[model samples]
Target chain A: MERSTIDLWVGIFVALGVAALLGLAMKVGNLTTSNIGATYTVTANFENIGGLKPRAPVKSAGVVVGRVSEIKFDATTFEAVVSLSVDKRYVFPKDTFASIFTAGLLGEQYIGLEAGGDDAKLQNGDKIIKTQDAVVLEKMISQFLYNKAAETPKAPETSGSTSSVVDALGANPLDNTTVNTTINTLDNKGKTDIAQPVAP
Target chain B: MIRSKLLTSAIRTLRNIGSRFTERIWRMGAGARLFGLIVVSSGECLRRPRLVVREVYFTGVMSLIIILVSAFFVGMVLGLQGYNTLQTYGSSEAIGVLVALSLVRELGPVITALLFAGRAGTAITAEIGLMKATEQLSAMEMMAVSPIARVLAPRFWAGVIAMPILAALFCMVGVLGGYLVAVPLIGVDAGAFWSQMQASVDWQHDILNGMFKSVVFGVACTIIAIFEGYDAPPTAEGVSRATTRTVVTSSLVVLGLDFILTSFMINI
Candidate 1:
C-alpha cells in the first residue's frame, strides 16, 4: 500500500478519537447544561458580617445545602444582611437559626444553618431571624488578656530589670519590649481586655 | 581620540541594527516558507484522498489515548487540591469551578499539545530528515512528485486537525478526574460539583478561543519540525541536531504562541 493510503486512514481514526474524548470531557467536567440542581434562597441579619463573602456554602447538620448569594448592609438598622441560596429540597423549620461558621484554622468561612422548632416550613425569601454575628478568635483572646491587665496592679518603677531575665536566655531582650508595645496597641484598638501578669 | 570614540559608537549601532535586521529577515523567510508549504500541501490533500487518511490516523487517532489519560489525572489533581483549599473556608462546593476553569483555560490544551508535539512532531521530523539525508526527496522530484504535496501537506494538515480533538479529549478526562476525586474521595456530592461547573463556564467564545490556541500550536510545531528536518545537515550528527532543534523550537513556539493567543483572546 502507498504511504499516502496509510496517512489517510490514520487521519480518520484520529478525528474519530478526538470526537470521542471531547464527549467524555464534557461528561466529566459536568459541562452539560441540564445537570445543575434546584436552588432556593434564605435571608439572615447580623450586626457585623466580619468578612463573609458571596458563594460561601451554607451547611445544615454538616451537609452543604446551599451558598451565600449576596451580602448587604441595611442602612436603617446598620445591620449586615445576607441572602443564602439553598437547594429546594432541603426544607428548614421556621425558627431556624443561622450562624457564620469558619472552617478549620486558617480555612475559608461559610454559613451554618441550625434547624429550629415551630412546625412551619421556611419559604423562599423567608428570614432566619436568630443569627449570630461572626466571631474572630484572635479578638476574643486579646479581649480576655486586656481585662486581666486592667484587674492587675502595675509594678513600681524600681522593678529590677525584666530585660535581665530574657538576656539570660541568650535571646534579644528588646523582643519583650516590642511584644509589650504590640499588646498595648491591640488593647487600644480593640477596647477589649488585654491579659497582663499580676505583680506580687 | 574623539574620532576613535565616534567610530566605535557608530560600529556598535550598526551591529545592533544589523542583528535586528538579520532576525527580521530570518523570521520573514521562515514565515513565507511555512505559508507556501501549507498552501501547496493543502492543495495536494484536496487533490488526493490517500494522504488525508494517513493524516487522520497519525495526527489524530494515534494520540488519543495519551491525551485522554493525561487529562484525567490532571483533572483529578485539580479537584483534590481545590477542594482542600475551599474546605478551609467552607467553600468546598466550588471544586467544580476550579477544575473546569483550569482545564478549559490552560492545562487541557497545553498538555495535550505538548504530548502531541512529542509524539507526532518527533516522528515527522525524523521521517523528513531521513528522507532528505537519503536523497529520497530528490528521487521524488525525479519521479515528478511534488515532495511538498506528497510529504509536507499531510503532516501539516494532521497537526492542524488533530490538536483540537486531542485537547477536547484531554479536557474531558480531566473533568472526570475531578469528579471522581471530589465526589468520592473528598465527599463533595456529585450533583454539587457538576452544578457549580455548569453555572461557572461560558462555552461560546471561551471554548472557541481555547480550540483556536490548540490549532495555532499544532501548526507551529509541525512547521518548525518540518523546516528543521527539510534543511537538515547531511550527516548523522545533522539529523540529531535537526531532531533537537525541532523539539526545542516546537516547545518554545507552543508556549510563546499560547501566551500571545491567550493575551489576545482575554485582552489582558
Candidate 2:
C-alpha cells in the first residue's frame, strides 16, 4: 500500500473509532433516562425551605419518584412554591399530601408525596394544598431540650441568705454596728483577749 | 579602546543569540516533519501484520504486568483512604465507588501512557534516529520502498491498540485492589461493596472515557517519538538530541491530551 494511502486509512479508523464510542455513550445515556418514563410536576408551599435545595429527589414511600425542579416564594402567600418533577403514570390523588423528608439522619432533604384518597388525578401546576414544612432535626432537638427545661421546677430558698450565716460564725455584734464610739472600742481592747500580752 | 571592546562584545552576544534562535527554529521544524513521517510510516505498517505483531508484543504486552500491579495497588490505596473519609459519615460503601472512579477516570490511562511514552517513545526515537543517521531511509527510498509504511506505521498502531487494553487492565486490577483492602481490612462485606460500585457508577461513560483517553495518548506518544526520530540531524549528536526531545515532547503531549480529554469527558 502507498504511504499516503495508509495515513488516510489510519485517519479514517481514528475518526470511525471516535464516532463509535460517542454513539455508544449516547445510547447508554438514553437508556438510563428512558427507563423511568412517567414524570409529574407537583408543587409544595413552605414557609421556610431551610437547606432544601433544588434537584433534591422527590420520593414516594421511600422510593425516589421525581426531583425538585424549582423553589421560590409567592409574593401574596409569602410561601415557598417548590416544583417537583415526579414520574408520569404514577398518579397522585387529589388529597395527596406532599412533605419534605430527609434521607438517613443528616442527608439532604427531599420532597415525599403520600398517596391520598379522592379518585381524581392531580393536573400539572395544581397546588398540593396539604404541605408540611421541612422538619430540621437540630431545631426539634433544641425545642425538646427547651421544653424539658420548662417542665423542671426550681428548689425552695433557705432562711440564712447572708446576715444569719455571718452571725452564726460568732463575730462580735457590737463591732458590726456603725454607732460604736471610739472610746468603747479602746476600753474593750485593754480588758478582753483583744488586749495584747505585754512582756517585761 | 574601551568603546571598541564593548562594540565587539555586543556584536558577539547578538550573533550568539541569533544563532541560538535559528537553531531552535530548525529543531522545531525538523520535529514536526518527523511527526508527519511517523504518521505516514504507521499507515504503511498497518498493511504488514507480522512486523506490527512483533512491535506490539514488545511494546504492548510486555508492559502489561507492571501496569496491572501498579493499578491494583493504586485502587487499594484509594479504597483505604476513601473508606476513612466515608466512615465518618457512616457511608463506608462509597469506598468502592471512589476507587473505581479514580482508577478508570484518571490513574489508569495517565500512568500507562507515561510508561509507554518513557519506554516506547524513547526506543522509537533512538531507532529512527539511528536509521536516519545510517541513511537506511535514504537506502529504502533508493530501492523504491517506503520506510514510513514499514517502520513508523506499526509503532503508531500499536500505541493506539495497546493503551485502552492497558487502561482496562489497570481499572480491573484497581477494583480488585479496592476489594482486597475494603473487604478484609475495613470489615466491609464484599457483596455490598461490589453492588454499590455497580449501582453508583455510570459504567458506560466511565469505561468509554478511559478507552478514549488511552487512544489519544497512544497517538500522541507515537507521533511525538516518530517526529523527533525522523527529524534528527544527520549526525550521532543529532540522534542523541532527537532521543531526548522525543521523551520530553511525548510526555508533555500525553499530559496535555489527558487534560483535554478530562474536560470533555466529565464536563469539568
Candidate 3:
C-alpha cells in the first residue's frame, strides 16, 4: 500500500474507535441518564438503610431528581448518615420526608423524597429531620406474627375480629406508621364494642 | 552398584529441573531489560509518528474484520441465551442490560485482546524473528542504528494505541448485535431494553474500567511478542517457535491480568 493509503486507513480506524467510545458513553452507559448537574448536597439520618447503596437513585414522585452520594455510619447517633446530591433546580421543603424504598418486589433500594408543606426550603448542608428507615422484611413478618399471637386469646370475644386480622396482615409494608396506627384503632374499637355487648 | 546408579540418575533428574527453572528466570530478566530499553527509546518512535501509524495500520486496521465478526456472534449468543433465561423470570426486557454490562465489563476487552493476540501478535513476533534470522537487526546495529527505537518501539506504541480502540469498536458492534437479536428477533421491548441498560451501566465504573483493561492487555501482548522475537534463536525453526510462544504467553498473561484488574475495579 502507498503511504497515503496507510495513513487514510489509520485515520479511519482511529475515528471509528473514538465513535465507538462515544456511543458507549451516550447509548449503552448511564452518562446521559444520571447527569444531574449543579447538585446541592443534603444529609439524612436513618436507623436502617437496608441495601440502599451509594449512587442509588433519589426519586421524588417516581422521578429521579438526584443520587445518593455517600453513606456513612454515624457513631454518635448509631444511624446511617446518607448524603444525597440533589439537583439545584429542584428544591425541597425543610420538613420533607426521606425514606428508603425498594423499586419492585425484590429490587434495589433507593431514597424517596416526599415533599412536606413547609414555607422554608432545605438549603445545602441541611439535615433532613423527617427520615424513615428501610422496612426490613424479617421485622415486618415478625411483627405480624406477634400481633397474631396477641389477638389469638381474644378471638372468640369479637364478632368481626377475623376481618381486622386480615386487614393487618394485608397492610402495605411501606406505610408502616399509618398501618400500625390504623390497626391499633381497629383493635381498640373492637374491644369497646365487645365490652358494651357483654355489659348487657 | 545398583544403589549407586539409582542415586546418580536421581541427581541427574534434580539437576535437569534446577537448570530449567533457572533458564526460565533468566529469560524473564532479559525480557524485562528489553522492556526498559523500549521505554527509554520511545521518544524516537514518537518523534517519527509515521512509523507508529504504519504499524497501527498493519495491526489494528488488519485485525478489524475478525474482531468485529467475533464480537457480533458472541453478542448474539449472549442475547439468545440471556433472553431464554430472563423470560422465565419475566424479565426479558433486561436482556439489554445483561448484554451491555457483560460486554462492557468483561467480554469486549478480554475477547478483543485474545483475538488481537492471535492476529497481530503472532505477526509481530514472526516479522521481528525473521528480521533477526536474516541478520537485519544486526546490520542496523552495525550501521549505528538503535533497532529497538527504529523497529520495536513503533510496533509497541502501535499495539498500545490500537488495543483500546479495537475493544471499544468490539463493544459497540456487540451491543448492536445483541439489540438485533433481542428486540426484533425475540420481540423484547426496544425502549425498555435500552432504558434499563442506560439506567444500570455506569460509564465510569464499566466503560472506563474496560478501556483501562484493554490498554493493560495491549502493553502485555505487544511487549511479550516483541520480547520473544528479539530473544529467539536466529533460525527458521526458532522464528516459528517464538511465534507460537507469543500467542500462548499473551493469552495467559491477559487472562491473569484481567482477574487482578477486575478485583481491584470492583472494590472501587
Candidate 4:
C-alpha cells in the first residue's frame, strides 16, 4: 500500500476497532446509556447488598430505567446506601420499594424498583424508606440446614400460638423500636431472624 | 525369537524418544529472560510510534478480510445452532443473548487469535526468519546498532496492539452476522434479541474482559512467533520450520491460555 493508502487503511482499522468496542459497550455490556440525560438521583438503604455493585442495572418491571451510581457503607446506621440515577422519563411514587434482586437464581445482583400506589413522586436526593436486602443463597442454605437441624420434634406449645415459637427464637426487646416493624405485627415475629437478618 | 527381538527394538526406540522429550523440557526458556526482552522492546515501542503504526497496518489491516469473513460465518453458525436449541424451549428471541455472550465471552477472542496466528503471526515469523537467514539482522549488528530495538521491538509491539483491535472487529461483525441470521432467516424479533442482550450483558464484566483477553493472546502469539523466528537456524529450511512452529505452538498456547483466562473471567 502507498503512504496515503496505508494511512487510510490504518485509519479504517482504528475506526473499526473503536466501533467494535462501542458496539460491545452498547449491545453486550448494557453500557448503551451515556448517563448524560435528564436524570435524577435517589437513595435507598439496604441491610445487605449481596453481590450488587455500582453501575448495576436499576430495573422497574424488568425495564432498565436507571443505574446504581454509588454504593457506600454507613458505619453508624449499619446499612448499604445505594444511590440510583433514574431517567426523567420514568417518575416513581414515594412509597416505591427498592429490592436488591439477582438476575437469576445465582447471577449478578441489581436493583428492582417496585412502584407503589402512592401519588407522590420521588424527588432528587429523596430516600426510599422501604428496601429489601438480597436473597443470599449461601445464607438461605445455611439457615435451611440450621432449621432442619433444630427441628426437635417437640410437642405443640400450651398456648397453641405460633408466637410461642417466636418467643423461643429469642426476640430482641430492642427490635420493636428498630427496623422491620411490619414483622412485629405477625404472631411469629421472632421467626424473622432467619428470613431477614438483623444488622450485627 | 523374532517377536522378542522386535519388542526389544521398540523399547529402545521409546527410550530414545523419551530422552529427546526430556532434553527439550530441560532446555526450556526462562521467564526472566522473556521479561527482560519485553522490557527492552516495550521501551523501544514507546520511543518509535511510526514504526509500530506501520507494522500494525501490515499485521492488523491485512488480516481484516479473513477475520470478518470467518467471524460472519461463525456468527451465522451460532445463530442457527442457538436458535435451533432455544426454539425447542420456545425462547428463540433469546438467541441474541446466546450469540452475544458466546462471542463476547469466548468465541470472538479465541477464534480471531487463532486466525491471527495462522495469518500475521506466521508471516512475522517467516519474515524475521528470512532476515536472520539472509544475515540482515547480523548486518545491522555489524553497523553498531541494536537489531533488537530496530528490527524486533516495533513488529512485536504492533502484533500485541493489533490483536485486540482485530478481536473487537471480529465481535462487532459477528454480532451483526448473528442478527442477520436470527432476524431475517429465523424470524426472531429484533427487539427481543437486542433488549435481552442489553438487559443481561455487563460492559465492564463481559465486553471489556473479552478485549483484555485478546490483548493477552496477542502478546503471547507475537512473542512466540518472533522468538521462534529470531532463534531459527539461519537457512531457508530453518525459516519454514520456524513459521510452522509459530503456528502450532501459538495455537496450543492460545487454547491453554484461553482455559486459564476463562477460569479467571467467569465463575462456575
* Each candidate: chain B TM-score: 0.88, 0.84, 0.97, 0.92
Instruction: For model 1 chain B, give the 10-residue run with minimal summed lDDT.
Output: B199-208
Candidate number of the best DockQ:
3
Top lDDT model: 3
Q: If you assessed candidate 3 against the hidden native complex, which CAPRI class would it receive? A: medium
Each candidate's clash count = 30, 14, 0, 0
lDDT of 1 by residue, A4-64 (tens): 5565556566666566545644643333542327887878999877768886778898787
Query: Tens digits of per-residue lDDT for model 1 on B1-268?
Result: 9999999999999999999999768865975677686675578788775676666677677777777777888988898889879899788988988987888778877887788878888878888999999999999999999888888888787778778777776777687788899888878987877776765664644565667778788778778777777878877899988888778877877888888888887732
**TM-scores of chain A across candidates:** 0.61, 0.62, 0.75, 0.64
Comparing 3 and 4 on TM-score, the stronger one: 3
The candidates' DockQ values read 0.21, 0.04, 0.73, 0.50
Considering the two chains of model 4, state its CAPRI-style docking category. medium
Q: Per-residue lDDT tens digits of candidate 4, residues B109-182?
A: 99999999999999999988999989999999999877878778888888888999999989888989999999
Which of the two, 2 or 3, has more DockQ? 3
Interface RMSD of 1: 3.8
Q: Residue-wise lDDT of candidate 4 within A17-116, one digit each (tens)?
A: 9988987897666776544378999999999998898878899999889889999999999999999999999999999999998886656788999999
Candidate 2 lDDT over residue span A1-200, tens digit each: 33544444444444544543443233222225424565667787888776798767777898767778888889998989999887886778989998877777776788888999889989888888898888877899767655544444432233753443333333333453554576677678768865667778
On residues B85-190, what C-alpha lDDT tens digit does candidate 3 reach at each position?
9989999999999999999999999999999999999999999999999999999999999999999999999999999999999999999999999999989999
Candidate 2 C-alpha error for residue A100, in Å: 6.9
Superposed Cα deviation of residue B70, candidate 3 (Å): 0.3
Docking class of 1: incorrect
Q: Among all windows of ten consecutive residues in candidate 4 chain A, which has the lowest summed lDDT?
A: A167-176
